[model samples]
Target: MQDTIRRNGSWLRAAGIVVAAVAVSAGTTLPAAADTDSWSYLTKMQAHEMWKIADGSGVTVAVIDSGVKDGSGWKIDSVLPGVSYIEPPFERPDYVYPPHDDFVGHGTTMTAAIVGDGSSGGPKGLAPGAKVLPIRTSVGTPMAFAVASEAAKGIRYAADNGAKIINLSLGWTPDWPMDKVKPAVEYAQSKGLLIFAAMGNEGEGKNWTNAIAGLPGVIGVGAVDPTGKAMPFSSHGPDTDLTSVGSKVEIRCAENKGWCTGNGGTSFATSLASASAALVWSAHPDWTANQVARVLIQTAGAPTDGSKRSDWVGYGVARPRKVLLDHEGDPGAPDVDPLAAPAAPKTPAPGTDPTAAAAAPRAEAADAESGLSWQWPALGAVAAVGLGLAATVIVKRRRS
Candidate 1:
């Protein structure tokens, strides 16, 4: 879910060198700013402004990534013991693992970004009070190739463990077909899980895979800079459902030893977006996943025209604040599947290889036609005018 972004024109050139230098000097020790209380602090005030009306206090989000170190005190105490898809020993039957044993701080950092308390001057998560369920799979792994199986396994495990919202920040080049994991994803959705996945960070590298986001029942997230511009490195396309503050969005880094800092990419954006859903769900626990998703898409801050949806920005930037605060927002149908593809075969028959069959060129084409689309009505004239009035008030307040 994580990737670095260029500062801008000239900063883009120096970005690679800067990351390399930082990686070398920092070694496995994340940069000093990576500490929760040090550099990337998202103030309580800011959090309130961003998501106070929709604080995700009671919602539970399952983080499927590298393992999270609960010992860091960053996670809420109510977190259930997580399950792992990695091999035995590494995949403990019980939840707790070795203390402070985050092989890569990526998981922990992401956890903080989604639900950190901001107690340590760390970046405050959009849903600061939400509980987290950490499922370790790819953290500390060698590369994408080494962990595809484990990643899929973790997703299944998380679904089986009563997670209502699942957040995945990892990706693979040759994506593991959804057919291979559709059953697990369907199981999770049946149990009312809202899955949020990164759209990938390889927009510049043509081979990037948008599998998780492309699949039905998943919210594909792209990245945007602080100024609300789409990042060049952030993946884009019709597959993307929403965008978020990705670049310069401060967060705890995987490098620093139990510290927090700033990083960028659709990965962090995905976490933030997931946390937003958690908050909305927490506020309205009775609403189904589809309803929650409908609110998000319907209230998303973007233009209404389908063609206007930039491959870079998707439907528009995600605005959890708008969804949470708007009184007239619709949550959509409770029983409907937001990602269901009408034409695709429900499941592979007895002995067939779902992946091999689904991966064939023709199958890919068929799936594309059956992919998910947004059917929510446009923000009506009244809602648009109301939002404009609110924005004006906000701007005036800021000016004062």
Candidate 2:
């Protein structure tokens, strides 16, 4: 059950994220353009080196964002049939045209970061050989609750469809009812889906913990700039799990017309992290989700040891290169949750009702660029028979 998403193909969050849209009537890549020069983040992350051994061939990353359409030139494959949660009134007007005319090109961008082949003159993805399972969910502006519910459902759809790594460049405000997303998160984890989410670009704001990022099994990610320093906009809290290079990142729009430069946020970092996981998992097919997760963390470039973690960068930056190159790290237990202890499902807090909360902007954050953590919720009523989505991720996040 979801509301009709606005078909203008736009998700403009007041959280300060500039949703750059570049319309290309002919190309197949995606949305958005940048005013800055191009960046080569994958090279900086040393993805090419890892590709020598692992190209994430067997892994499938489920991108839960606007929608995905592999543009004309890029060599993207195995985008399994996807379903959209945006109801009719707001569905893309050109639905019959192609499957991935993503409104904001957000999902498409994330997908490319995970699996785009460089052949199309677009930016190359981290795990170019991995498959993508695109699941469309509403994101940005006026509808926090609806976005949460829709995203929850999308997560389940991805996991059920055989996605090994689930990437969510989306997140909810701190006070939004955790209940809305908790169940779906749990369900996905139970099925062995490794969840990756943006930590929200709210670190300089109230610096609160993101509801989805803070969940037990979810790997909350932060951003690092070209200099490999923490980005000021990335969300921060004890709950943050890891950091990745989110700044100066390049991603071609869905239509493959133009690209965004210097894009920085947990959203980009989340996809990279997910792509990195795909590399590790693909290289070690026998490893369980938990084992893959543990190896990634173990090989992460941490400045400190396990006893202390940075408040801003969490377990330090994601360096799948270290894991891939060394080929040695204790995966620990095959059936264990690495992020947090198990907890019972939480009910909505009294006086903190999801609807009553003001669309009053709460330190909103989405993409990099000085975004806040949460936009105030828009008032609208929508529903679905069962949010198999929300329950799916919460199951994974809460798994012990």
Candidate 3:
């Protein structure tokens, strides 16, 4: 009896455990003004202070999504030669980029968030100086089976290339158990690539399950609002590494022209998290991925009572500004991986009960009363995974 939530004029079931399309709020806006409007998120995070120390100039982050579109203001050189896993045999097997017909604005929006350097009339990126490696999985549907293989190949490609960070805005389903993709995740980490992924946008909906939110070495990001509080819709209960501003974010759309304010989800949060990593890595070029991860966790803005972590907010909103400007981050040991899960890896057998899988009880409201009845839809995607994290977050998913 999963809770069903309706978003953007459609009913979505949580039983399926998928991160669906964007929930749009209708409003018209002029193109962003130089320092105000859609790009206000930068100001809220005090990004300028961090900018003085590190602008992500030397780092390259790989955006694994639908496709990345460039606006006129975007630097032609900053966007490296990327490859697409979608479309026909149009691109060479080794290197390619996205075609124009991106179904939704997801991938483009993410690119803007991570590294768009505002030009004549373009929006400024959080890591304007950092390069983005756009890897497209398909036109739409993050969960489709064909897209799954593409995403895995894309991860390996990103690592083998010069990608220092990889951002995965899409999620996978727990029912499908994305075991196929684990090897690729391991490969990227072995290459010292810092990976960040979205926690899914199902908190307010049916409160569905999430996959790999607690996967070892993968940083899982959640969302927060303007006041620096976790949104009620942000899925809680652990497996989240940190929080970032993700509500009503405005970005240049992938398929269309101009900015979109409707973008919201852990996907966007992951981009900001990815950008934060770029800023740090760019500043301290000699630091290892573990040092960056430890600093992010150590300097994260946590509870006033002084706990090291939070389930919903994770370590709290990423404070890269605090890390760089205030010198508050401890780089710690260079070799220690910060996101390691407590236990050894083990795959659950088929039909393993989800409740038993849910490790920690959610710190928020009690579980939804289970009387609601709704038919689960058949969306054959192995992509949408992670979240409803609980046990994975609280208990150690990696060995100590």
The candidate that wins on TM-score is 3
lDDT of 3 by residue, 18-108 (tens): 2232222223333445325455668766777778889999999998876766553567876776887763422333333343223344667
Q: Taking the tens digit of each residue's C-alpha lDDT, what string does model 1 give over 65-122?
A: 6667665446557356676654432334343333233444556666777777655544
- Candidate lDDT values, in order: 0.54, 0.60, 0.62
lDDT of 2 by residue, 311-358 (tens): 466666677777778666788889986665553554655766333222
Residue 295 in candidate 3 has what lDDT? Answer: 91
Q: Which ten residues in a row have the lowest lDDT in candidate 2?
A: 372-381
In model 2, how large is the Cα lDDT of residue 286? Answer: 91
RMSD of candidate 2 to true structure, Å: 8.7
In candidate 2, stretches whose alpha carbon ends up further than 4 angstroms from where it belongs are 1-40, 76-78, 90-99, 119-121, 141-145, 252-257, 304-307, 341-400
Cα-lDDT of candidate 3: 0.62
Off by over 4 Å in 1: 1-46, 49-53, 71-78, 88-100, 143-146, 175-179, 258-260, 303-308, 338-400
Instruction: Give per-model TM-scores.
Output: 0.69, 0.74, 0.75
lDDT of residue 391 for candidate 1: 9
